[model samples]
Target: MRAAVLTGFGAPLSVRSVPEPRADGGEVVVEVLATCVLPYTGEVFGGRRDYPLEPPVVPGPGGVGRVVRVGPDATRLRVGDLVWCDPTVRSRDDALTPDIMLQGLSSRGEGGARLARHLPDGAFAEFMRVPTENVHPLPPEALDDPARWSCLVVYAIPYGGLLAAGLEAGETVLVSGSTGNLGSAAVAMALAMGAGRVIAPGRDRAALDLLADRFGRRVRPVELTGDEETDRDAMSAAARGPIDVVIDLLPPAAPSSVTRTAAMTVREFGRVVLMGGVGMLGGADLALPYPWLMRNSVTVRGRWSCPRTANVGLIRLIASGTLDLSPDRIRTFPLDAVNDAIAYAAAHGGPFDRTVLTPRAG
Candidate 1:
């Protein structure tokens, strides 16, 4: 087997041949078909807080793949099945409850039984052995180009957040960072879930135009100028109508002005869902309107990962073709270029697109 192995913090991943894995009892070996290029891969490279990570490991949250080998004890899935192989799973036990077992991110777990991120080896390889229960069969439409559909999980990030915030049909939504991978996913799901209109704000104008072109008029674009008042006014005008929900997908380190702009765009008593990694924000304080929130009864919430129920519901919606997510752009890479793929995702700023690595030998 070949994988992109990270040797240490801030080191580039090296492509090297390693031992191919066999499906142990209760596990299944997937011939990697496609995996999303997550920006968080860079965080793993730099060693995020309390992660206790080291080199010589494969890092991936998992993606769509076909079952190549099934362990003797595995019952639900069979070889040749196309499935979503995100290693993370929700756990009720206290030991793993903080975040659904931190699945697909943690590097330690005993193969098929307990939830763990695949240590020493990850989905950025030709083959990966995953827990049988973690695999969910996907529809044939998704399988035709698994890389594109593999992004269904990203959209689920916003879907779950919206529903949890008590989203109502025909409500309007304002999504910050609307041109990034997660932001773009949020826009798609907001419309599919029945948001009457969506306002997408970002720094790039071309990307905004592109999204507006794909999603049609229902999606309005907001270009943020560095000038605070200018950006705020633009956002407010785009969202002239009351915004039912505000989805904050900005990087944790983003300027407080971004949140303030988003806050100003929301309608009174509207909800705000702040989500995603802390990398971009980095402890920045939000310039929230305390008086407004108190007077209008606004509720603010934070979320980590998509809960199991939300993940299941979104998958059903996509499988039923109710979500119509085929407009997403997917960039392809070979197994040998996993590092480049991750870097590309980390550097991309123009438009939202999914970077996918294909490990199958052609």
Candidate 2:
């Protein structure tokens, strides 16, 4: 099989022929149809702390493909079924264990490594393998519109964050980095989940306009002009009386102003869910003022959407059409063009709503 092989950190992935993966016991081999590129992939390949996996490793978090073969004990899925595999792979024991997930973090079980080896050799490859548990049946409609399911890969994080924050219908929520992929998803999901209003703050007016067109009056746009007083006034106006929750999806190295704006905008006693920046690529240096958090009685939370349980709900939401994701948000490339795709995403200032790699030409 031809795959995008990462030879080293900070190096371009090359198209190379690799052995076709077989369905091992308790696993299934998937004929790769589509896999999405994550913004974090570059940071991971660049040897960032958020991605601990050594390079020469395949990069991907979510994909949808057809099952060609299945291992014994993999009863939930069968050959010829189309499914979306959960990006996070974990063992039964680890799932039961306190806090370990597959691929992105260290774990005691072989499941993570094995599943990592299974996924399309690289997310940019022709075929892949995964544990049966990793596969979720995709609606035929979703297969016709791959972008809908592909964006699910990126949206899952915000979904989990909103759920964890215990968001309720009719409550107002503020999202930082509203133009990025996760930020856009947060805005969409908050509206779909019935928030009274979704305030999205960002520096990119074009992206904000796109979101506003999709969401209409439900989406409020804020532009950060790099002026402290302006940002504070914007936050004050956006927050008004109070916000029920604040979803911070800023990059790891997001400008300090953004973090300060987020800290200032959230309502007192409201939850601030940090899902995007703390661990991964760029937003690591962002700091929160401890005194402000204490004074406001704000609850700070961190989330990484790697649990199977989380994926299950996300799949159901897609099936139900509540997600309302579209393919126009995605830009597709062949496995051989992985490097080009990564460079494009970086240059575009992405957290793309969806970017996919296909093993074969459509």
For model 2, the stretches where C-alpha displacement exceeds 4 angstroms are 48-50, 95-122, 227-229, 278-296, 349-353
Candidate 1, superposed: residue stretches over 4 Å from native:
22-26, 43-52, 69-74, 95-120, 226-233, 278-283, 287-289, 347-349
How many pairs collide in each candidate, listed in order? 9, 9
lDDT of 2 by residue, 1-362 (tens): 88777777777787888888888887777777887777666766776644445456666665778888899888677687878876666545543553334442222235555544444244466777676777888877767866446667777778888898889998888888888867887888888777889888888888988878888887788888888778868866865657778888877667656766775677778888877654344433556778888998989887766456777777777678676665346777777788877776666554344567777546
For model 2 the local lDDT of residue 51 reads 48
lDDT of 1 by residue, 108-180 (tens): 2343224343333568888887767777888777767778776765776788788877878889899887887
In model 1, the clashing pairs are 7-55, 88-103, 251-280, 251-281, 252-280, 252-281, 252-282, 253-280, 253-281
Cα misplacement distance, residue 142 of candidate 1 (Å): 2.8
Best candidate per lDDT, number? Answer: 1
Cα lDDT of all candidates, in order? 0.74, 0.71
Task: Show pairs that collide, candidate 2.
Answer: 118-129, 120-128, 251-283, 252-282, 252-283, 252-284, 253-282, 253-283, 253-284
**TM-score attained by model 2:** 0.86
lDDT of 1: 0.74
For candidate 1, the per-residue lDDT at 161 reads 81
- For each candidate, what TM-score against the reference? 0.85, 0.86
